[model samples]
Target: MTAPASLRDHAYQTLKRRIVEVQLRPGARLVERDLAAELDVSRIPLREALRMLAAEGLVLLVPAKGALVATFSPADVRDLFDIREVLESLAARLAAERATPDTLAPLTHRMAEARTATVSGDLRRIAAANAAFHAEIIAMAANPLLSNVMGPLAARTEWLFRLTASRDPVEQCSEHEELYGHIASGAADEAATSAFAHIAAGRELSITLAEKWSDPDFDPELIARGRRRRRVES
Candidate 1:
């Protein structure tokens, strides 16, 4: 049977969303046959979808065993946060300059939703709402380059933020609310600074937790496998 034109596109987006949403955890092996069946697509198109994720650094292609979700080291998370600080700082500044009532309204709604979701004790909804809030704010900058620069970093940081579910949600909700207030009020520098502080605080907390409760029995072979894939890709 000939594949539909949207077959590969659907697989690519489905896999990417799953990866970014952390449904596919880091170092989790992806079985091709299972993925094909799950996606209701042929293995041929699924392979292309995997390649797309590899290019974006969301999935790693092992030499023989094929692809798995990419893992984050503390070092990797730190590097990502550093990049995010720079890119998002610029985004905040531009968003301040470019923001309109129309644009900011959606962000405001999401921000409020985020706070309510946190209070309602719905971790998954809070996570989704939080992501939506920040994403819409960044989008106000209207610069493709800025969004492109921050996308992967944001994606990688999400797993760390998931740790927040176990901690205080009000703190996070408050942080975003304050940042959004600054953006809405056209306090450009204030918004940017607050954004940085928010991200930095999360980075610090996540780093500490990662150290305290790190995986005790990590797979050395997996690390080597990841390293070899990097070498080949390079």
Candidate 2:
């Protein structure tokens, strides 16, 4: 028989999922007492789980206020995007060179599904589809090093993509189509260039629109701390 999962493992995965799915936005408080009671586990396991997430850059610790989700300011947004640009450029280049027809087919399916999901405007499916698209490409790169490099950054990248999706989503989907074509044509450098620009544009849009999402409920402390990005509002 399979052994039961540990409490700390359960707590870690549940909390991580909640944060990545934006149920716990950046700077959203994680009240230990409330969470332990709600999760029906003792504080010990919950605290342990939180410590794990903190190491992963998903949760933040405070001297007195407990842990909250980590907030991204304009600088953080650009830095993360710059790193992804480097990593993804390499991934795209390698995928084009290394991907067989069998490998390419899966990525094509993933992108097509993502495009369909985007056209339908179902945010939940869009999130899943987007992950599938990126993951398929990452896998096609056939580099263990790329996956190792991305393991820690994956959660934050997903959060950033969700933020990007909230902005000019149609443009984002169209870029994915262009990327698909470039990769299909065996243009590694071209695909890399297009993917880099697409990702960079999304990152810029996320930072520029960051203030519009701030409110008392979403993240009061960050709302107070973040300078408005100054985009024209409709």
Candidate 3:
């Protein structure tokens, strides 16, 4: 018989899904007692899950303030995309040099799904398919270290995409198709160039949307004060 998942694993998956889907918005406080009760898990496992999330850059643990969803600034967005562009571009180049027909097949299928999602105007599906397509490229590269580094960044990218909701799905799918062609043909330089352009475009869109949606009066000090008061009350 298969072993049951541990409580910590379950909590981590559930909380990560919620965070990625924006059920837990940026900067939302995660009270351990409430979350433990909600998930029907004890505090010990929940705390372990929170630590894992924090390590992945999805959660922030203040000294006495418990956990909160990680917040993004324009600088943060820029930094993330900058690193993503470099790493993903390298991944594309490596995939172009290494990928076989079998490795490329999954990306081709995902591109079709992304195209359909684009036409249907399903943002969530578009996002998922897009992420899957890129993930396939990373897998094709066959570097464990690269995969490990890109994993959390990919999750953060998903969160940014959901928050912005600004990508043109049709354009994105077209770009992916182009990128796939380059990789399939073993055009390493072209594949790297295409990947960099794709991520650079996304970075701009994310930054623009972030600026539009950001609160004008958002004060970190005020939030810290509120957290302190809550801690005192509890």
Candidate numbers, best lDDT first, in rank order: 3, 2, 1
Which segments of candidate 1 are over 4 A away from where they belong?
1-5, 211-234
How well is each residue in 155-181 modelled by candidate 1, as lDDT tens digits?
A: 455545664456577888888878887
Assess every candidate by TM-score.
0.82, 0.82, 0.87
> Least accurate stretch of 10 residues (summed lDDT) in model 3?
225-234
Q: Which pairs clash in the backbone of model 2?
A: none
Query: lDDT (CA) for every model shown?
Result: 0.71, 0.75, 0.79
Backbone N/Cα/C clashes per model: 0, 0, 0
- The candidate maximizing lDDT is 3
Q: Which ranges in model 3 have alpha carbons more than 4 Å from their true place?
A: 1-5, 213-234
lDDT of 2: 0.75
When 1 and 3 are scored with TM-score, the better candidate is 3
Error of 2 at 159 (Å): 0.9
Candidate 1's displacement at residue 36, Å, is 1.5
